[model samples]
Target chain A: MSNILEVRGLKVMYGKSIAIHDINISVPEGGIVTLIGSNGAGKSTTLNACLGTVPATEGKILFAGEDITHASTAERVRRGLVLAPEGRHLFPYLSVQKNLLLGATQRSDKEGIQRDMEFCFELFPILKDRLKQKAGTMSGGQQQMLAIARGIMANPKLLCLDEPSLGLAPAVIDDIGNKIREINQSKGTSILLVEQNVHLAFGAASYCYTLQVGEMVAEGSVEEIRNNDVVKKAYFGG
Target chain B: MGVIPNIMVNALVLASMYILASLGFAFIFNMLGSVNLAHGAFYMLAAYITYYLCAKAGLNNWVAMLLAAIVLAAIGIVMERFVFRPFQTEFDRVVMVSVALMTMLQQLAVQVSGSQTISIPAYGNGVLDLGFMTLTNEKLITFLVGLILLIITLYIVYRTKLGMQMEAISQDRLGAALQGIQVNKVAMLVCGMGFALAAVAGAMMGAYQQVSSNMGDNINVRILMLVMLAGAGSMNGILITGFLMALLDSVCPIIWDSYTASAIACSAVVVLLLIRPKGFFGHEM
Candidate 1:
């Protein structure tokens, strides 16, 4: 299958300091790919570069056969590249319904938007019940769910989730992992999930890339990454 | 006029005008996270434009005011694009740019209107004489127009999709962008709306009072106090504080002189800020 996204030799810089470098990653059509790393491993930075939030100083980003290296963030989002950013960067004061509606701000197809709204409700029913509730008032897990649901409302071609499992209970993490897989399988949407949680990454993603200190150190199928000695020692604390 | 009724009418007029002007200032402060010191100058400029159109161009008062508002709105969009957006994230630079803008606009107002104090014609020229109090048509019209404009603004802020996007953008800019919101686009519209509202207030006040070069200074200070006391992110706070501040200004004048009224009202604001440093409804920036 053709890749939905391909990043070649990507390098991102923060002033004189480098955030991520020498990064090459791809997400195949209708597949789940996770970039796993420890703190300060440039995982979120990589996702930011993809979403055009942070400029990539060096490299080419091709999405579905088109180069998007210098596109504005809004233009990129309009082209169906979306992110559920790290720490669930929700509009805390807004209601859940407004949050979801904001997710579809780029689109004008009313019917399609309604259909996606229903789909999001199905993916996380708690959101529908708390439609009028402030997003920040929800528990962490529910906020995460709302964050992802908000992303889904955009009906993205490639949904990049940044650390959805962060600050959640094990049970909630498991629930999120299942939702990730279900989203991919059911909608045939491509996903590039950035995670620190190796277990959730292993369960949800078919292909995995291990990032260490802003570099792509390893890339393989889930089983290979799961059994890799270095990944085990570093991420799993073996 | 009876002192009680006079004070009451004056308070209502002041409150409505202050509220209309400050609402725009608060939006700019909340959304761009910057202080546009030029906002007052913009207010003053609108008054001059309205005055020129009414006096020189021979347009009807309402049409002249509307045209002046449109002109300011267009200038507002340009300012947002060239002036405000570039320095949005740098608070110090934003203030500096606004101060420079304020100076330029003030100079322009002086150059156009000449240092002489000019005023717009009364919107209406009649009075309602009741047994208890007399109400001038001018004051009644000013208050009613201001109230109607305030209602429209509230409706736009609370009841529209664009308003929801605005709320989202104010709370979390990057998050709003990730949701595919054109942050700059929304901001530009907000700037236009804000300036338009300022223009309307300026024109209304121009009719109600004499227009001086430094008229913006007093109103700006009052707006700053209202926003500071209301806090950073709360519109409702501005709504409440606008009336309270106006009431203080109006009531104190009846007991003392205008100078003492100003002092008392300002001191009350200072004390309120001392009591709530973050403002009554503000969250952390």
Candidate 2:
């Protein structure tokens, strides 16, 4: 499949410190591409740069064959590059329904939003039950579910998830993996997932990129990555 | 005037006025995460602007009040884009910027209107002798304006889409940006609303009490204290705390000297904060 999103030589900096350096990544039109790395591996920064939250100090980001390197975060989102950020960043004070509704902020299609809300309800039935409850009051697993569901509500062409299974039980992590597959297979949406859980990442993605210390060290299918000794030792614990 | 009736009227009037000013200050502080010392300047500047339009430019007091609100709101948009936006992340710089704004506006007010206290001739100078109490039209008008404005503020914050976005942004800037909320535009809108509220409060209170350049300086402290007591991200808390503080401001002077009354109020606030730590509705912004 043709690439829906591509980052070429992208470098991101935080003051004097560089977070991601000369990173090249892409999400094909219908594939799950996972960036598996440990904490402080510049994984989240790569996602932020693609979403335009962090400015790319160098190189270009092409979305759907259009140059979108210097776009505003909102513009990037509107153009369907949505990120369900790390930390499950829900508006803690707002009700769950409000949080879910806010996910479709850039869209004015009332019927479409309603349909998507129903879609979220179907995906996370707990969200429907806790519509009036504050988002922060929910359990961690449920909040992660809500975050992924909220990201889906944006009608994203490419959904980027940062640390989706960061602090969840094994069963919940399995559930997240299942949902990632469902999103890919059902919606035909390209995904760029950042994860510290190498096992979950390898299971969910067709292709994986191993990032270590602000650099892409490996890129291959799960079987191919298993054969790369350095990547296997560093990420797969081989 | 019956002593109790007079005090009650004073309390209500003062509470209403203080709420108008403090609500604006609190929202700006929460949304922008800035102390916004310049908020008081907007209040003082609005009074002078209205006063100028009425007294010098030959406009009706009511018309001038509307004009002042619009002008101040427009100025607020410019300020948010330039003065406040640059310092969004740096709290120290925001404080410094606001201080500079306050100084310049206060000087302008003093230069234009002098050191003496000024007043807008009451909205309709008449008293309603309701047997138990004497109430002037100015007192009633100020209270009504305050009440109506408070309602509008509540409605905007609770009912509108933009208000929802503001709350989201105030809660988590990164999360809101991820949701494509266009945070800068919302921040600018909030600043406009804040300046407009300050203008209305200043114009009304100028008629009620006095309009001096230095008037804003003292009231600014009162507004800040009210906000701190209310805590961040708690707009309703601001309204409640504002009323409580206004009652203290009005009632304490009757029982003791003004400074002693203020001391008691401050001490009580300190105790309450010690007990709860996060004000009444303390939530993170």
Best candidate (score: lDDT): 1
- Lowest summed lDDT window (length 10), candidate 1 chain B: B276-285
TM-score of the second chain for every model: 0.95, 0.94
Q: What DockQ would you assign to candidate 1?
A: 0.59
iRMSD computed for candidate 1? 3.0
Worst 10 residues of 1 chain A by lDDT: A229-238
Candidate 2: which pairs clash?
Answer: none
Task: Please give, as one word, the docking class of candidate 1.
Answer: medium
Q: Name the regions of candidate 2 deviating beyond 4 angstroms.
A: A236-238, B1-5, B129-132
DockQ of each: 0.59, 0.64
Find the candidate with the highest TM-score and give its number: 2
What does candidate 1's lDDT look like per residue over A1-238, in tens digits? 8999999999999999988999999899999999999999999999899888899999999988899999988888888888999988899988899889889887889999999989988999999999999899999999999999999888898999999999999999999999998999888889999998888888999999999889888899999988889888777667
Model 2's DockQ score? 0.64
